[model samples]
Target: LPFWNKGSHSPSNHVIVAFEAYRQLSQVSIRPMTAISSMANIHEDICATAKRKEAAVIILPFHKHQSLDGSLNNTRNDFRWVNKRVLMLSWNFC
Candidate 1:
């Protein structure tokens, strides 16, 4: 499950397994987010927190998309809002 987190933009096994798990589980909310912030450092913090928490629903590819900054930054921010107690329990990907 932890293998999905490769530290950067590359799909890990954990992400695939997590996606399948989500399909089977059907109750958990899997939300994906980008990895960017206005200050860049804040984005790094968000990413760090997510890594610490073993986040699920990771942003894939990390490619140059149109809304990459906005989406990922928001998701990271949202993940930060609830990272204290919540456990993602899923794999990650790039």
Candidate 2:
């Protein structure tokens, strides 16, 4: 799934990333379902999407805290919490 960054510094980059990911996955014969949302509500959006789509798994990227340039830092205090929440919520679906 793709998370939409509504007020991000680089919004177009997110689209490019999503498209590239879709292309690579398509090459492997794996079609992925996608969704978009702001970083703040991504956890809730993911859980809602999973329920709506009846998804068994959710894959998240570290891009939330790290940029495409591979810089690693704690950009958001809730990043860890969001990760944990997504993992726990996905497990409940499974």
**Number of the top lDDT candidate:** 2
- The TM-scores of all predictions, comma-separated, are 0.26, 0.45
Per-residue lDDT of model 1, residues 29-83, tens digit only: 5554444555424445555666776775335333232574555323354445334
Q: What ranges in model 2 sit over 4 Å off?
A: 1-21, 24-42, 55-71
Candidate 2 Cα lDDT to native: 0.67
Query: Which stretches in model 1 have alpha-carbon errors above 4 Å?
Result: 1-25, 29-38, 59-94
How many clashing pairs per prediction, in order? 4, 1
Per-residue lDDT tens digits of candidate 2, residues 1-87?
454455675754565567567767777333365577787778888888878876655666543456689977776666677887787
lDDT of 2 at 84: 78
Q: Distance (Å) between predicted and true CA of 31, model 1?
A: 7.7
Among these predicted structures, which one has the highest TM-score?
2
